[model samples]
Target: MSATTLPIPTDAGDLPGLLWLPEDRDEPVPGLVVLQEIFGLSEYVQQRCADLAALGCAVLAPQLFARLDPPVAGIEDGDDVEAWLAEGMELTSRLPWERAEADAIAALGALRAHGAVDQERVGLLGFCYGGGLAVAAAASAEEEDRPPSALISYYGSALPTLLERAARVEVPSLHHFGTADAFIPSQTVEEIREAVTAGGTREQVRFELHEGAGHAFDNPHPALHHAAASEAAWRLTAGFLAETLFPRS
Candidate 1:
């Protein structure tokens, strides 16, 4: 699947994004707005967009780290994982949470407006930092009467602070977490699951916990990757999206 660079309009300016469309563009398909991790729109993220497109959805991932001086795009976890992680964290710190949330919502709007997308069937997916931002966008969208049809979040780092809002997210949602995540405790993950699932229909929320897996288990980096966990999470995510947005009659 080939991806094209496009500009997503935002209040600040045009946010660069990678767009992937399904091969059968004769009809508009479900659209998905993907949020980038702290490392920016790395190869892993772009590949995920392609995977989503292959699964019969249009995907767009905006550059949330574009606020940085040099505009970080893609950074791999080199030999010095700590150094790269720190660089990514620094880039994330420079971006205000409010602005990042707005940018994410803007990306969703752009995807919803695209001619190749089924606006009523659009959704949002994000990882780590983007995961948290997705939650904020969901809340905003709900208030604006433009909520996504579904949401997928992987180990949202700021979920603890957004629990109240999460409880109000009525859309079908799938969340992935690691039991051994050093940054977020297992107890916290449990709390997040409870909060996000609260007040929703019985089948509206799903949480998958990977045993023995740490943070960023899907990154494919030796320091963080867990093949088993990543595969399981992807399977769950793919099934969830298919059922929620492309149900078979």
Candidate 2:
């Protein structure tokens, strides 16, 4: 129940993160990395870390932008958000997406190496930008090190683009998209579905379409949230997590 900020030990540097531990730590806990959206670790992202902790996992959400001024920040949402997101995307454009890929892998590594964490039982959950990070994380390594047992993405950005190189994402990946997404049209969604099926194994990949939600449907911001889509996505994400990462636990 108590959530606190902590440093995530990484070979690159000491990454800053928010740690949420269960009220009862009677046993070693499963590990999880809640990758941030482009907006960074905002209240919504932090709350999600808490939610995962309540599910019995030791969760850490790293401040990936710590090197920048204001180690922790929430991107201001407005007409400015588009520019901010674009600039943020540009910053990461040079950021060796592969390195971010490694960092997600290292997060799981650090958790496993923590001794307090059970390495065998690990998973990742991401949203928006992080959702894409989740898939890249899943696709980044061999089964031994970065074996992402489960994957969940909410209106993941750049998915269709990545589908062009879809073979890279061989792990169990699940996607949720809003039917009315201005960013991704119905035709594009259908194309993405085709790419999903063509890109990898059908049995391991699943897609869900929400009736009337746009991008970032899961977030609670009035300009973005869709009640029905958000609820449905959450239910499906939770179920996927339970089945893939903790099947026998």
Candidate 3:
């Protein structure tokens, strides 16, 4: 696994970012932005970058919390997720959410300048808070300048509140949710569907609900993660990215 740390410049602030590339690959590759969960860019998020690198995609993960507080390096899902999150909020709360969104966009520009990325074929994938941002960022882009060919969101619970904007998402999208997500109730799912439909982006939205799962179902910890749901979502995400970003000519 080969990786490096880079910086992103935005109007709000400068942010640190991580880039992972497969070993012995000298050719330009499609880029994929791996947004972190609210816990910050912990080890799991870095590991996901390596995982995507193994798939031959150049992966970049921006440390959105850098301006507020540099988060811990490795944190797995468990009872402690909230504790780590509290630490993160201390720094993040200092930075306006609007700024973070701008930083997310800036990270893409930085990645494009690295010379190893296919600018026209970028993709964005995020989990938890990042998941909702992934949808919003992709949707917010104008068709002629969109950064992502595909968007993947895992348990994008906050989206319902921002549905007015999220509903504008027109890129081909794959969304995974736990049927039992306490964060996003079943009734809310129906409402989200209505919003997506209202946006007229229904053809671009593909929603899937996993049975016997809950929030953060994709985390690896058995106590906090649902193995079946995690694995299932991974498969769907893989297929979606392959189809959208690495499609056959």
Q: How high is each candidate's TM-score?
A: 0.96, 0.85, 0.89
Stretches of candidate 1 off by over 4 Å are 199-202
Report model 1's TM-score to 2 decimal places. 0.96
Ranking by lDDT: 1, 3, 2
Question: What's the lDDT for candidate 2?
Answer: 0.73
CA lDDT, every prediction? 0.89, 0.73, 0.76
**Which digits, one per residue and each the tens of the lDDT, describe model 1 over residues 107-187?**
989998998888989999999988888988999999999899999999998898999998888899999999989999888
**lDDT (tens digit, per residue) of candidate 2 on 1-249:** 667777767677877677787777766877778887777777778887888888777887777766454454555555666686686565555455666667777776676666667777777778888877776676665445557656677776767667655445555667888988997778877887777666434778888989988988888777788998888887787777777665373
Ranking 1 against 3 by lDDT, winner: 1
RMSD values, in order shown: 1.3, 2.8, 2.5
Task: For candidate 1, list the clashing residue pairs, or say none.
Answer: none
Clashes of each: 0, 0, 0
lDDT of 1 at 69: 80
Q: Candidates sorted by TM-score, descending order?
A: 1, 3, 2
